[model samples]
Target: MNSSQTEWAEAEFSRGWRLILASAFGVGFGSIGFVTYSIGAFVDPLGREFGWTRTEVQGAIAFGVGLGGFLAPIVGYMIDRHGGRKIALWGLVGVAVGYLMASASQGSLGYFYLAYAAVALLGAGSGPVSWTRAVAGHFHGRRGLALALTLSGTGMAAIFVPPYAVFVVENCGWRVGYMALALLPMVALALAVFFFFPDRSSPGGAAPVHARTLTGFTLREAVSSYRFWLLLASILAMYIGITGIVPNLIPALTDKGFTPTVAASIQSGYGISLIIARLGIGWLLDRFWGPGVAAVTLTSPVVACLILMGEPSYATALLASVLVGASAGAELDLLAYFTARYFGMRNYGRIYGLLYMGVALGAGLGPISFAYLSQISGSYTASFQVALALFAFGGMSILFLGRYPRGDFGHEARPA
Candidate 1:
């Protein structure tokens, strides 16, 4: 081929790959951020339908997360060995089927439990570990922002899912809510089959077939490293602080004397902050160490939680909610990006898979966890105080990450 023809063909291939990747990104948007995110909104409906207590309904949510956490290591190992396409595609199948099952659950708690277990299995397949590893394989230079943009599915989900779920469940019934969720995975599956790059990248920049398992470090090697443990600690601290307060935000604010409507509105405001922060964090990640970006984003919650403590008025609650939302919003991106950078994308799935279990674990404990703190004192006020402390500790811990890990994905390491 002539130079011009070769150049044209290369450009065409890049465009096709970009489309594939973007489509995969959308699939991810629906899978991780949308499906999992909308669970909380359905809790009330489940309670009403089954005559279950709030605590009982909360137990189911915890069960799903715990199940997901338990499954993470296996899922990560699968992705690391096989490439993300198959696992993620299969995940979509699970989600679609799970939602369908949940829709049929009606008043049966057993059915609800079974359906959510499927959803949790699906979650293990497509969650942060799977998608982040995909982005990590594709780019090293812009990996942080790349991870952020794809993971922004959560930001989009926070923006879109709740109100939609509320409208469906309030007017139509909870079953319809499940039916609506069923469609999301079809999108994921289509993209996975046609687009997800199912290979570890080649040095020549050509795509290759899914290959046999090549471990980055033996299980022994990983456990011996201090870095791995530190990263794990950071992940746990982050999830506990963010998920703990958020699940209870509406009640916490209402207890502080805000009306339920106002409390709900505060969550919306928080979502807006999170969306804005997500875009800003994505831009920043391209230029800075993810940990540096995390340091700023994580500490944001400390200020907000402290403000929350004052209960100065409803206004403080509103402001605090947004700050917390923004912090929580950007957090998964930080963890994902850091995993890719610190460890290398070669084994990103297995490494991050274990790390993401922290999120699952923290989520499982979010309700009972903070309640214990509240019990230790008197009320939500004291419990939130402990949350704020953890947030601060988590924020400061990012500083210990030292400089960001470096590599040549494509772009220069633009200074933040």
Candidate 2:
């Protein structure tokens, strides 16, 4: 093997990857474990126990996740100023407290709302902004793979959390489930951040100049750049498309004649695909043209939408889930990578914070939009068509990014 290729290989598997991967696990529990993955389980129990309507239980999600979108920029700023380690520790504490609040719910809808909003607002630190920043700063030559391994944590959560929560609730009860969710973030995540995670900058100190150069854009420059806006547009479209289909995945499959159990099994492909896409796409980005990889990955969802619009079958449903999950996985990897590539890391926390709003907004809106479409048309065909068009638009826009920034394309060579 060539000397440079060997160096790159060594760096890719270095010990640092383990640390970042561990941090990713902590970040995943903070996000997917307690928040996204666990919420569905909460819905049924909350409904049965308190007689809360589905809409009311779901509204708590909207309140927490939507308002958190507004606070993302603030969290990013804190990450930039305070460093990821500190922010992550604080965020884990907030997550634990939020779930404790959920566990203590006394049948008040207002109290439920408060519980959710508290998590989103205070737990923003444990989100992508904090965890990803540390990984991004540490790895350069193999940044793509490093980030991929880190993000695989969310995929892990998707696979693990749903069944785990079910097992807990089935045996103990919902309050116990909430308490279990809190412990991972409070004890595990806290320990991970303190013992393993490293900060790019010393606590309360300035970032190294080279790190700033690598990040490229300041907060103002990032907001004003056409490329930034383009990326945001793409992010929004992809999220809207994926989330639109995912919420209705079971029903959509059932409509196609699959049994409920089979339909649920097909949905598992999404989580599996998520892990594969992150690693495969990350590997490709390091070798190929970056934007080209994004454009192709994002465009695959259009085919998934088309399949959903066609005749029903087990094979077709599984294919659609895999394709959609691939695109969904690429969303954050590209978002995190491109943000650092285009803008400098000096303000990465804030810029990424603003960009993640797309994630929040689309996830919140996508499901509702799909439901509205199904309600109106009495079928999912119309929603699939709309999503297909948006995915295409979003994919094509990546071409406008032109190329990776100067010095960004495999320029550095460092171990660990």
Best-fitting candidate, scored by lDDT: 2
lDDT of 1 by residue, 324-353 (tens): 878876788777766655665555667777
lDDT of 2 by residue, 29-79 (tens): 764233655565565578799998544665665555666666778888877
Listed in order, each prediction's TM-score against the native is 0.81, 0.85
For each candidate, what is the lDDT?
0.65, 0.73
Worst 10 residues of 1 by lDDT: 204-213
Model 2 lDDT, residue 110, Cα: 97
TM-score of 1: 0.81
Q: How much lDDT does candidate 2 score?
A: 0.73
**Number of the top-ranking candidate, with TM-score as the measure:** 2
